[model samples]
Target: MTTQIKMTEPQMLQQLLKQGFEHLNQGQIREAADCCQRAIHIKPDLVPAHFLVGLVALEGQDRKTAFQAFNSVTTLQKNHPAAWAQIAKLCMSDGQINLADNALKQALKYPNKDPMVHDLLGTVLSKMGEHKNARKCFQEAVTLQPNHPPYMLNYANNLIYQGELEESESVLEDIIRIQPNSPQAHWSFSGAQKATNTKHIETMQSLVSEKNIHPRSLPFYFYAMGKEYEDLQEWDKAFESFSKGAKARRETVEFDEAHEVATFKHIEDTFTKEWFEQDQKGHSSDAPIFVLGQPRTGTTLVERIITSHSQVHSAGELQQFGLAIRRLSNHQDPRRFSPQLFTEALKLDPQKIGGLYLQTTEKLSGGKPRFVDKLPQNYLMIPLILKALPNAKIVHLTRNPMDACFASYKQLFADAYLHSYDQAEMARHHARYRHLMDVWRERFPGQFFDISYEATTSDLEPNARALIDFLELPWEDTCLHFHEQKTAVSTASSIQVREPAHTRSIGRWKHYEQQLSTMMSTLHEQGVPIDN
Candidate 1:
């Protein structure tokens, strides 16, 4: 008779883990969790089992359980690379950036061979505004997996943000070669450089002409084609590509107009002038300088001007203030900014909220006396910001409504500006934003400094002087030389901001007046003025 053997507990545990991982990959969360839990029960300190559990929890959006499971994995096996990477991701999302940085440092102590771990680690660092460090991690990932287009793309995108355009273009070229049909690679490659000829345009056109192109990728190809046409001065072809791209992209995301309406109404209804005047104490710090307004309205340009000062450092697009308010309010709504969340945020103590925000944001400040938090969407949080940091300086960048709307509509963002893909929705949102800002100006006269993009770009010196004066800082010649600064810009305006101030982008919407009738008519109906 042939010898028969029953599998040992350790071997059985390995089999369970394999099944768990397969189920996780298949999106069978409960099945994966059951397998992991069984493995854990058999060997309570099984690190891989716990790590798998953490991954499943993350997929299910149970961050608490995910953190616990990851912590368990780290406890069982210190210097576990993937566990630390996931932990750092959670910490970063919670606005505990210093903790995330610490976690990353721990992860880097060991040799991590996994490309995904490096990519995850790099993304957290990117969100923390440590773009240089993030670039290193992305490079490591790219080196580990040269054939993977996503890995190479991550490296290239960071290169662009860091203003390494030549390298970005080379890397993108490689990505295109590796995957000849990648829509994203084409889009990114088009953005990284201005078109000199129609050669690459014809290449992208061939790929997009394939009837089998996926719906999810249609936007990228179309946007790339649109940009090339725009550069070539073929306005009609550009608009056609832009509209088709926008329509395809719009189908993939969700945006509720009613939610935005209520959220704007809630802010105006609650944060009255009298409420701000109330002696409800807030964190007393004068280190924050907020550069905010609608996206594509010169917010980044102004932030660059402000941070060109020796005393100011740029903290790119912080989520801390909103996270602080949300955490302290004890409301666990999933949406970033919502009517429910905003209403609940009113219950928070300004002092506590402000204290948490500064504490989390402290690590991003580069020993500067003041720091610029250049988040355009922060215009929505102006009332809270003033209440929380009374001495904070707010600069609102204004642009012609049509120009601003058109600019956003043309560009493809990475996960934000949801309404930009639809002309009517984009116009209505802009109108609402303008109305709320007017209310804020009336409620808190002289609380903020407003500068128009047109005026600032046309008369750089006087506007720059006034801006410097608003912050009570002595004027410096450096503010006028922002384009020459060595700081890496991580926004849509990255490439353009590298050049001296110019009014070339002004009245750009006029080029598309025929194509943008829906947007202009919507703005008119909403009573939003087209002029700055």
Candidate 2:
């Protein structure tokens, strides 16, 4: 037989690119990324190679690499709408909404039929406080790709945000019809609080126990089942479902309790009362009304009320201050409150850090005099916040420990909520949170207004008025009807906040008190006062 002729470089590149796409589709992310890199080496200007590399990098969670690769695609082809679309997505994730908007506009300027670009543009607009424009983008995306579940879901979310609940429910049902096996579609519909269909619930329950289904989908399936059980008032079954959901979620992320302990210890030691008493200058802005607490502790409820006031803007869960800490620490970890970082944050110029946060938020506020930053974990950064924005009002939300922690445990966050995965860990974190709050009270006397969920829900108007007075806002009846406000809440409380304030959530932890024994023991060991 004649000797086999070696394939040419172009042939090799084509073969590699095809292999990369195949591997990418098959969930072999590293292998796909490697193939793309090899293709890029053989043909540096290959647009498909660069695009695949960006996609693989994004899937592998290397956003920096993805940004560069996608940017490269644009350089090679100026009218590349797909590249611009990805650039917009990456920019949004990096908290660059303005840039994302510009990128999306560029993407739409081209003759592109891609629904994802329109979908992403919708999300960017929503985050920028452009609800009407966002809805339009979502509508266009859904029209272009009627069968795509994600497009339908995004459109449904926008519809819900605009108080079109019936329309939103219809779209969600359409999603279930199109993709009957889609766990996310079923899970999303459960949040509408209208899951009366026994067939759908049974289908989701069966999906949860199916070993053939995706492992990542298990968390959502379990949580969806939990929601159904809770709706039916099967308390024990509900708790069991929620526990499985939390366990499945925890398996996906590595959260070290030791690391968390070390981090909190660092915060306690670094930001003392004596530290605040020092002659330090900070950026002064009455614009910031900080609502700080553990997650699910009525921070969102209070935010809804506060933002309903005409003068206040709702900048949901800002990461700017946390970003500032990361800037000082020189650590890339988005969670910047660790021992390795806090000391460095303490050493930085407070005014500069404070100024950056205000500037970033003001752009999002649309000239509103006051804006709410309802980042619950900002409790850990209270000292940093106080030292940076001295004139800002702080609203500390307190909930019954069991209610707060258990509520958090039941949620499957879009991102990592490491502490919420385990009850004992959650209790430990709550104790640390309470300790820090006490420290804040001791150091900055009369500077904080503590709002209790139980107290507020028990007597709504009186506490609502107190909260308004604390913000130095003139009383408006709008605050009393926060649910009537058109602005959509993007939190776990999204559905709950749509209804009038009620005490149904009060003493909710009693339903599963037996299951929470480990958490209760941990809280007691840490000197937290459990209720009678």
Model 2 clash pairs are none
Q: Which one is best on lDDT?
A: 1
Candidate 1 stretches with Cα past 4 Å from truth are 1-8, 22-38, 59-62, 209-212
Q: TM-scores for all candidates?
A: 0.94, 0.93
Task: Give the runs in model 2 whose Cα sits over 4 Å from its true position.
Answer: 1-16, 97-102, 108-111, 196-198, 334-336
Best by TM-score: 1
How big is the positional error of residue 302 in model 2, measured in Å on the Cα after superposition? 0.7
- Global lDDT of each model? 0.90, 0.83
lDDT string, candidate 2, 81-117, tens digits: 8889889877766666567778878887898777877
